[model samples]
Target: MSEAVEPSEWQPDWLSELVNRSTRSAILSTPFTSDQTEGHLPAPSEQQNDPISSGNSANASQPPLADSESTHIFDYREETRLPVTPSGERSVRRTLKGIHLFVRIEILYHNAPRSSNQMITVNATLGTGLYWRGGQILELGGPLAVLVSFLVVGLLSWAVMQCITEMLCIWPIPGALSVYVSQFVDEELGITVGITYWFTYSMSFSTLVATSAAEFNFWRGINDSRTIQGVVIYFLIPLILVLLNTMRIQIYGWLEVATGSLKIFFLIFIIIALIAINLGAGSKESLHYGAENWGSPTDFDRDAADNWVISLLMSISIATFAYVGVEVVSSSVLEAKSPNLSKGGGNPFKFSAIYIPVFATVAYCLSGVLGTLDIAWNHPHLPRLSWLPPDLNKDDKSPSRAAFVVIALASNIPGLDDTFNAFLVFTCLSCAATNLYVASRTLFGLTSRLEGGEGRRWYLRVLASFGKTDGRQVPLRAMIFSAVAFWWFVEVLSEMASVSVLHVWACECLAFIRFYRCIYQHREYLERENIALVQRWSVKNYSDYPYRSYGQPLLAYLALSGCIFVLLVANGAALWNGFHLLPFLASYLTVIVFIGIWILLKIFRSAPWSFVDLSQPKRVAEIFRHLHDIRLGGTDSTEDISEG
Candidate 1:
């Protein structure tokens, strides 16, 4: 059904070295399968010179594409037609319904591996510090705090997801938040929001690289053997990942699956082990001190405002950081052979199944241990209590190593501590590699004119010059750029994950409100033109979206309000704990930076609010027309799909 390919051309010198970094996305992609996609490929002038002239036969004036095999770099296409049923079934455009492996890799890879790593350091990473204000700001202390924080973060993340899914479905394109905002809202938003997202992911990856080095320190001798070994690992890990990512998407998906599954199984085992230990199952004494750990705080410490709520609020915000990468579902909207996920309630398969299970399981297990420990009446006499991880005070702050510490102290199993630390190292490496990979793609998408909008034209050109591959698949240059930047990790950036996440969540909500209006306007355009419609949006709100987002303006508003609420209150703990200038500034650093970037773009680009382009054929009616034609078993001769 596809055209025969031309012979391969010589590769560019720069891309030649990273040739292996490209993907099967080149092999599987069918660019501009319909006119809607091709229509946006060029404006008036470029249209005359466009090389991939879909239906044009004799374009003698145009030059050939540089390489016959070169894939288009900013290919933001989404194949939305679901595999339809046979004549026996009546429901139209039935979704794939269950988990698809490739889709899992796209969304889960960003959050799951890294979040799993978060579980290992639950006692130390600033996220759970919310629960233990009296002991250590960033360390998990007694068991009760862990359980409460886990559930709190999970619920907050779910709310953000509710807001994003619909917008992602509406414009299931690669540039993601930035691109959507540009189309629905304004170009300045598209540019700034996109860069903020890219910046957050990049910063997160760098912090992971730094964290990876710290994980190695746990194994190296205390006699300074750690310095050299940590340095070696810091440089080596990113190089290995850059090389690994050179392979195809299938390989990428498989790698995530293998790593994520192992990580999940490892965490699940840890939970069961803790529960067994709590019940005295493996102990010589077989102690069963049931639910005593879930009692009460021994002492009350009031905040600056003399209230405990400030401590709880700060903890919730910090806990929110643990769930940072969950929005990758929206950021990396994979090609689904189902009604667009947003319109159809939500992703029934991967979103609910794979993402939730691993994250929830980790939270539950970590919380179970923490909650029981915190509330359990003083059991200092019990030998098992000796195994609990030590408090991470500010002066003695090191790699939290909480999970490894717990295994070392609690269990008599000979190699468990070594084994657990080894696995933690592997998770850190895997998560860092995947984070870089995701960041590379986001960078690549930003440079392109995503769906014919005013993309980061000059900036994308500059970045792509150094970041793109010859095959135009993987952004190997971007990966290498990211790898080098890993060494430049800053402490403030590490502390800004929750703020960064909230920033993007707020943008997605705003974008959705504008998108709703654009869709309504597109319908009116069609009506005024007297165009024959496929999906009847015959009313004020059309129920024709193959995958309709669950709650639109209302739920979107709720999510936005929640994000704003958290952002405002998230900094109280830091302010109350030290009452210093730098910490206070750093607490709202992400918000300030986000706004600062947006303001700069507004001044430079000066994108007019009234100039929002709603004519890009992204409407549901336009999207579903060709799919409907194909589903009815019609060919080019049977139905004309070309735009009038």
Candidate 2:
């Protein structure tokens, strides 16, 4: 079961036809640089370097020479690109000098796709998702269930991250979930996964913006016009993000560093402030954390979670949402700096990825403990601020603030509270910007994949073209498109955001499982070639992979099981207690849409559901380039571990 049976000629007939197709050139298209995910057959000149052919024309199993067309290959070791100077622009050297010192690093933007630091921070920020986690405290009747949710989410995020890291190292391509799944499984399945991923992040533009605006409004006086201010804030922030992103990735990276620092600082501040407040270090009402008048009573009679196992499942759903963007790191492989090199030799994401998740776990853990305590809505004090709205009332409404209760705690610090609260506003802005950037990149990758093939949708071609940079170093069209989608969702499909995000997380786990199976079959093919089991110099064998996943197949299985459970119960909010149709659809809409796309593609492409043969490895075997370093001038990197 560990390896699939070998196929005839060690390649499927269908693969040859696919390699000859024009669409093959479109493979592995990237958002930052122009990499797309397509399959192709190499030319005769190229085959001379292919290990299987031994640089000779007499090899029996080599593919036919590809057409005389130019193709770009992404070298995991490094990236190289010509300056994207606009037509009739100044000389490249002159252009560099004219650009600001900060933006001059634009050369590296295309040369080295992702730096380790950027990857780590981006991963952590995605995981932190600063404001989204707070939406649950109000109706989570099961305090115990919420408490367990923190641990469950942490483990699940680890599993998913491992799956992505392993696959990206082996395949080393963009479109992340899309690229890996398509190469390992059915192309349609890959598209389904990619589109879902695209939708999840793209929709966040409006969702994150709207959420940030709401959080910002919480601090304003009741006399302020909340509606007008919210609309203005929502529109204003996205504009800043879009402008910043359209410039260059370095600009984007700097922003991430700045915001990421702020995000981490604010996150720590919240945690510490909460602990201090609980200790009664500073408070107007003298309320004790979780004390009778200060905290909530842990009452099972008051919770559906206490009586029903299903209620705990609901709590798990909430936890899963909290961990949505952690996988953003996977997409960075194409542009990540020195992906082939380790940190110190390279960059920060490696360090940040580990701690960010830990911080998230602590935050969630503290949140669960704090949720059952004196949440803002149930706070025993604040009568002096009677002018505040009922929802913001210092007395009954204080407990609903849950993790945000730190703001009130800061109030006790006099000189420090308002400044800390202003930082919170900056934190929200940072979160919105980060989510928006991820969302745009994801859509760009997805649409690029769609641009290939004879019957490819016309609109997809236009969109794919839109994602391409016009020498500006960013995907402007894609960013604008994503922004529009976000605003539309915020205004119209607002309710669908929660369910859609949950569905995407579950799909991430499933895609990894598919890739795991694909690699096993790929190994069986190389076994017949008598290649070394773990040759980093060659990609013909499974162990030849630079970074082998830890506890995979097993971790994948464990994660897959957990994800399935979450996916099934994700709709519990509507169905468990009452079976409301809209809520059910909101939860399961992504699944329904995906299934429909799967069937439609199967019919059109004449590919059956069983096209992916688990027992025998096929189509995908052609994908692993045995040449290893054909573009690097006949050699692989000395560094074996590409990502941690």
Candidate 3:
């Protein structure tokens, strides 16, 4: 008050000075806000270079902002800073916390959409099938048979991945299997396949949870106690998975990364350990038993020379089941920020498409070879329970009874079996979580089709509600619905769930074949069109085509043939050894259900009887034009295309 300061050079009181310093600190500390404002549009070159921006076509279609709008972009950033207290003073800790919160929000906003990294994709694909089912494959078919089955199935899985990946690179839509099948195949078949696939994952979740409970029982040395295992299986495990999935998808992705890394390390360790054990590194008496088990009786009947063929066919079905999750990467394409773009780090989906089947195949073949050498198929400690019949005991094999555990026990290494069993438990839980995530997302995709329409049907409105996302973009209702519905479904038919995997895969293969036919016909039509139109619409142009799989049309045919062969021989063991009622029903029930659903949908929804007319030039042009627009980062222009 004693000295009058000019308005231009005003000095604040102590409280005002503190407030000003806090505000300045907050703004300066916020990294994103300092460099860029909200709704800040990048230059065209920068947009093309940016992976996230390149993939998000909706942003490219937005109108340019006015000058006033550009300045106001920072207003939200300013409002998020530290608030002034009544006395115009704030604590140092509070100021720091505010800055920390702002930074975290900004970071999450940028990174959350692009959460499906390489590690997560690998982990989600590498499920519990190999760990739990490896011993069974070895037991059914000797080392040679197991190796052959995995190699064959691996080839089929690889072909299927290539076919699905090509289509996904263009569409990248959620619930992609159904949408593609509907467009290129029959509509009723597509809906039926989608529902069946969703059920398959849901049932698989229950199967994996039960498997995890068994692994836990093995760990605790309480195999006879059903009550504790039931509690863990039905209640504890499901609760944990539900809580995990209900959070932001980023959290699920990171969790998969951690678990997937552990499983991969375990897989590497086990393979090395088996090889070491086979080479007499950890043997009690330093006895090398390389290829000794290959000469052991491969067939359970142990009578006929041709029984090995039956065993190989039976094991192929199990091997196919093990490879089921490899294609789940396609399901995740929708959530990925830059699914088709490879500008920055390489595209995750493309990497997964190539990596999963190859790695799974090699790992499976190596484990089969080493596992068979470590112990004979008929060893006393091989975990084949005598109380249950041989045909029914496949579902009862626990981690403790797995071939790895038998080898660990034989190696005379103290606590080795315990350690392996613990990892198996973790693997089972990881796979269960993955299955649940896939199931919920599949359901979310199906329900998404029901959105944005004023529907007369109350049932459709009910289904559409499940598609709605929360503030964090988590499909909470879908997650809840899938969990509840599948939990009860699993309780009723756990055994049948294991068999449904083959049927679901078969449907996927058929869908891919139809997809290939459509693509081939379109290409042929484009070749006959005028050169300018052909150039505009041709998928052969790399600039317009986001990604293309090699050996396509040929690859699609191979996958279809291999899948058909597997379906014919999947239940051969039962047929050869005198058919058992439960196993027979389990093997073919999904087929019956699939056909039933297709018929129902055809009648109620009036789905088309035949596939889409791909030979028509107009249809081909429209399909290619939509794809061209998507490649150019334009709005989806296919809304006018009829569902029929």
Candidate 4:
């Protein structure tokens, strides 16, 4: 055998060596090169300026030098290029390149940023609804009424969550509500639902801001004057919310985590405090009043005086408001670090679906029971009492008169009312921020579907521009537009927010019916072809999906029927008592707006009025195949050929 050459002496010819060096260097620096990888290279200055990078550089061990000609060639190229530049500039460039290379490598190997793992879902769900509206629910019906209405709506909410979570798991997309409505139902309905949903969230945001301002005024004991409250609501609150939303989504997620944790702790503390007060804790006389204030289960204390049925029906509308933000979980799924159900460590969508309604129901039921026990339903200081003097109920009927606040005042504890009011303020602000986020995202989703080609109308192009995201992926323009559009109507839209929520839920229920119908039709089509084919094509069975909800089509049916009943009867008592223009308008305005949008789209854009056709087997098969592709993580395209 020939003698083996030394390792260092085995260099190839110049051409071969050059090719080898270029290939090796390219492979080593591929992650930092924009042409090679999808990720962009960070500027050298950015690496040097990053505090985390600087800290890591101070402690991290240096990487071993490459034992190849490629490294020496790269060094030689850099040395020759630097001779023309100043020594200081050359030194800085070299240092920055080194830091950048280190950082990019570390990021690729160790600490990639993940947006999905953030804790926004639960926090966004527990917004201003429960805290601000509890007293109102208590006043509409007694403690028993509160329990019934919450359970009724809570079950309805659970069904809606199930339907939404199942869809989101298989096809997580931004503006999910509108897209589902459009694809399963009709494009006209989808546009209406999207704009209506955006409007609803905007109104909710304003309502929360006003409520937060009212809470602040209550805490400061400035209930007599509207001046400070106006400033807080119109200027301060809106400005802060806009600023917060325009920042990175990660920052907003962290903020929600902090506020959401506070809300949870406060809920636990207040529940315990309520139990203690009922058991004679915090009372000087040691009086134990347990469940005495619940009164008759069918009592109609306000608005529906003689008819308990109407009172109960109307209370469902108020309770529905409390459950509105729960669907924010679905709206937020697209932003999650792992939208795929199987890829994430656990299914956050399912957890949110199960946790939110259960938590809201339990919390609302307990607070209702314990609150009415502390303060009678017919208490004199109740804000909405019919017999109360107009002057007494005038402007003083702010959050200071909330049932929990009234209970705290009667608890005889020092500073308890102030503390509770502070929590109320926190809840309102947190929710306002959430509402803004949801509204902006909805607008972004809506605008994204609009065509902005050269042939499109000017207004359409302008609208589509809102869909474009910044480098950080935040929809900055959409957020500003949403905030500016609704800020002026903060005080006026408070009453409309609850009714709008009903409209949104009704639309979602209708959308779920169509979604179920699509699946059923697809199954029927597959069964007719061949029984064996149904098993072969696993899309027919819900269990074969990545995430399957319990009690599917039947649950969807019940939810739709329940939603319809509530919509028809919601605020019916107000009209029956007498035709008050404001209540009637607030109750039916969203419906009118929904119809008007459909009509406008039809007239202008010639949009189709009917639901998507499900009769064609070939089309249905394609849709199912697309879903299968999604299940397999084989594609990232949000739209399919069937959408056209």
Candidate 5:
């Protein structure tokens, strides 16, 4: 059967009450702004041009009259009070209940195109996607697969994220990408990108949770299922989506920047600790064991290189999780404090450009050293190192009780074991937080597009209970929701860890495939939009673009390809040995589930035009605006397309 389907072609449900609820909620609860001062603002008669006043009414009973001051839609006094400022000060000044209705309608429901900077903030403050990918790597990728998967998926994730960001500013939330694209080029492309990203990110998160639990067993000796925690995290996923989305753009942006900082610290500490331990264990212990201990003699056969390549792909897949944050950075560009924009000057793109590489490099180094040490330490019997090389003469013992148990073998400081254990706990917790953040945003984005009713007053009320100053913005809601989703994902993955590795690999393989396809689909948009490009370059400029295979995309492609190949090889290996395929069969079933979801999206839920549907309405407007300004005979000065 054919897999392709037209996008965003769903018929409007005339009889559906749910549709009305979503529409009412969405239209009623648009985040609003006041262009005038309270009280100082003239009556409706004096300020007929006011956008806020034009849209809302202070009194519905009052009849329209030439001198409309008596019926001025918005009271200047109530509207001008600044909502809780971003500086974190709470204004206790309260208005009468009578004026409150006007303020709520005029201020809270003021639906307007937000500044690009504000949009960027919303993208950045929601930082769940980053850690979600990281944990996936730990779970889905094995030692051999980590590096390659990291490089491939990382770049793709970044590009896909940028594509989503560009699409977002065009329509904002509540509309699907297909709807936005339909406003510009066509609906087919919009549905194309929409279904692509939704499936890619969601499936990616799901596979990661499953894989992480399995991977945890490789290092720690605890009962594999019980030892791993946080499967219950995904339940909170729905809530996080709502909260972060409940606010205006600016609030969301600050939240991302702050959370990213915290994430960076945890990542750094782990990198540093892993490095210190690696460095502390020098070649002095090289005499104790030969290379065969880490892998069998058969492992070094000519096929080892192919196996290694596959392993690298798996690693890249795992590491791709770390790169998840880069997309948020790309999305933040609109809200980025551009020097030209009056509101702010910090660009998340710039931060992520530098931040991603630095983080990746640190992680790369940490993984290599840690992986090598792990291979070495996992030997049958060897003296565990105490801040030094392993002593071959000492009794052999595996520090499998806990990852921190390795630290106990190294240091004798008081509570050193506890301290190390605490760090490990913190790492897991951080991972959980990051996972929640990513899952919630993705789900919220999905829900906002899918749901017709926005549930406005209730949403605003939710934000208010948390003491919202102006009663708009739900950062807390988003956070809590994300946490719940994270919990759910963790629970699913942990429970399934006992399943065979091949099964985990299949789900991961499908996820990686979807992720790559999503990025590939957006290549044209990124190039045309020149969303973040500073210069123009041809495919020939990069060795990896089309033919040469050393650069980013090529490396990523090769890695993904290798994953599929190796998965087959691993499965074949088991079959050749006459081993059971129960685990493999189970995993195959999971992959089948994803395939089903994909089928439904392609046939039933796709947006109008695939490529054009990728762009939102506002983005379409922007593109046409720029295109209109271009002189027919003359060349446009700006080049679009940036490094992934």
Candidate 6:
């Protein structure tokens, strides 16, 4: 049981606002049980602090909280704790899980919703984009690439985290990030960000499929399986993942903890192994085969460039997926316990502060050293087809004919080959499992939105009844539905790997560009608009990062600026380079169409047209005349000034 509160002599202007937001968020987060209802009311100390308390105490009156007065808030201290169960009662723990709702919210709200969600086990499964074909690159990039990517991703992730943390730390809502991002950003930015998030989720599922396929391919070669056998084995991995996900959340958490431990173990072990092998070889060496490998006119050189770049990109793509789940913490900010005292929400700064450079460094040391060792011995040759440590390329019967280039040159040592093989196997399995969990959860979040509001409503209603309301809530229906979606989506992506990497690269690049533009253009409103939402929810001192450390907001300004230039070139190259240009054109056009659809949706949803429109409500009416086609039927065509 918790201690009884005493009235504080000092009061801040934010106190009433904080209490009101906390109470409201508790009410909205989930259904509460009779015992859990205390969270929805004022603390006993707060009740004593009330001006009316003096009169009541003088009259020797019983507390008004015991009466059925039904004011804006009440006290529920006596109702919070349930009696402890007997030692033999196993079922009691299961029942007690539901009671944790109020307690979790209190901790989250006070601590700032971001930390709780970010530190928990599910975060490892949620934020990493482990679900796509190109999801492994960051996980395997060398130090130079990892360093660059980390700077970019770390800052971006941090910015997003700060925005979310500020908005929901005080109030702590389940859909917290979306709530703030939607409110603070102009409609253009809001809708675009929403669409980007949706696509990221979708692609994450695709990454999972691609990763599983790669791992299965590795395994098939190791075991000397035929193509059909490999396919069967590949298909079965996701099934096990789905079954695991379908169980209760605690079970899922335990599985993640176990799997995560294995992953970290393998990653650490590989790094140590690579360092040992390198040290034994008695020479520090460069990992790159040099700029010469980039490309040349000779057929062999051109082919080498293509293979190396493509393989490197593939690795980077996969690594990017690993980082995707990092943002999953933002979704459950509302259920954090005591958000005001804790007061951190979706601040990716905190989460990614740990995520970006740290993971990137780990990836570089592990994969880079391994690659260096492979290349040192193999001398720029790809891995063997036999799936053995002496071989960089596994003999798997996948459509990917390009071999895994072993960058590690230290393979000359005795017993090293066997150890490397063991390490590779563990890597494949760990990455596969991580991807599956991410894919499952992303699908669930996506499906929850597609189901309209009913799915979320029911999830909240259940919590409400338990008096266990909090922002970090989970909707079981969403998870189940997501698992089903992942099952189908993975299959489709795995079968579609034959398409040229250039085409796929272009599509991904364009999508990234559009997302960057949306957020960049409305950076100010994106931060400012979350205040009301933060206030309403009693999220403490919600505020976004004021400035990005990396130059300007626009992504087009970076050294990677050439990549966007390449996207344009790739568009033309694909059309002219041989295969039918029509398919390429169609796919490229579809990407544009998707962006356009989101823009139109924002218009129809009564979202403000620009950042300027966020301040001038009257201006909204003037612009609506020209933008009447954008209006939708649900919410009013104008901003709800009263609500703000």
Clashing pairs in 3: none
Task: Give one digit per residue, the lDDT tens place, for model 1 in 1-644.
Answer: 33533212221111111111122112111222222231132233343231122222232222221112113333222222211111111111111112223223322322321112112112112121211221222232233444555566666556556556554433444456666666556656666777777777677777766766765666657226755665566666766777876654435545555665665566556556556655554443323333443344321123222344554555555556556556654333321222221133223322432344245435544644542442222222111111124433224333444443443444565666666566666656666665665666566556432222235345434554542343424556666666566466667666674467677777777777765655566766545433222123555424323334455567677777777877777554546555655445556877788878777755554434453554664343333332232232111110011121
Query: How big is the positional error of residue 14 in model 2, measured in Å on the Cα after superposition?
Result: 22
**What lDDT does each candidate get?**
0.45, 0.46, 0.56, 0.56, 0.31, 0.32
Query: How high is the lDDT of residue 153 in model 5?
Result: 46
1-644 in candidate 2: lDDT tens per residue? 12322222423221111111132222111111111111222332443333322222233243421111112111011112111111111000111111111111111111223343232233224332333344253234334555666678778776766666554444333466665565455656766676677677667556666655655555656217866665567666678767876765545565555555545566667667656655665664435335541244333212233343554565566566666656665554333433322111112233223444565667667655654443442333211111122443233444233245343553467644455546556655555565566666666555532322244455444654644544544556767777777575633254455456554555556666865665565554645543321233354443334455567678877877777666666445436555545556656776678789777766655555663454544333334432211112111111111121
Instruction: Say which prediction, candidate 5 or candidate 6, comes out ahead on TM-score.
Output: 6
Question: lDDT tens string, model 5, 1-644?
Answer: 32322211121211121212221222111212223222121333443332222222232211211111212211111111111111121111111111111111101111122222222222222222232333223222333343445555444433333333333322122222323333343333333333333333343344444433333443344324452334332233333444444454444434433443444454455455545544544333432222433343212112112444433443442343344333332212212221211111112122232233344444543443353343333332221112223435446554333332343345343454455444443333333333343333433332321212243335433433322123332234433443433334433343122122222222322332332344355555544543221011335323111111124344344544544544444323323323344433532443454445444434543322143322343343233222211111011001110100
- Angstrom error of the Cα, residue 432, model 3: value is 0.7
Q: Which residue runs of candidate 5 sit more than 4 Å off their true CA positions?
A: 1-325, 330-347, 350-358, 374-414, 447-470, 475-595, 601-644
lDDT for model 5 comes to 0.31
RMSD of each: 11.3, 10.8, 13.3, 15.5, 16.1, 13.8
On TM-score, the stronger of 1 and 6 is 1
| lDDT score for candidate 1 against the true structure | 0.45
Tens digits of per-residue lDDT for model 4, 346-399 = 244555555566767787777777776777665544545232224443454433
lDDT of 6 at 363: 52
Off by more than 4 A, model 4 = 1-118, 220-233, 284-291, 295-297, 302-304, 339-346, 385-400, 490-492, 524-544, 622-644
Candidate 2 has its poorest 10 consecutive residues by lDDT at 89-98
Q: What's the TM-score of each model vs. the native?
A: 0.67, 0.71, 0.74, 0.74, 0.46, 0.52
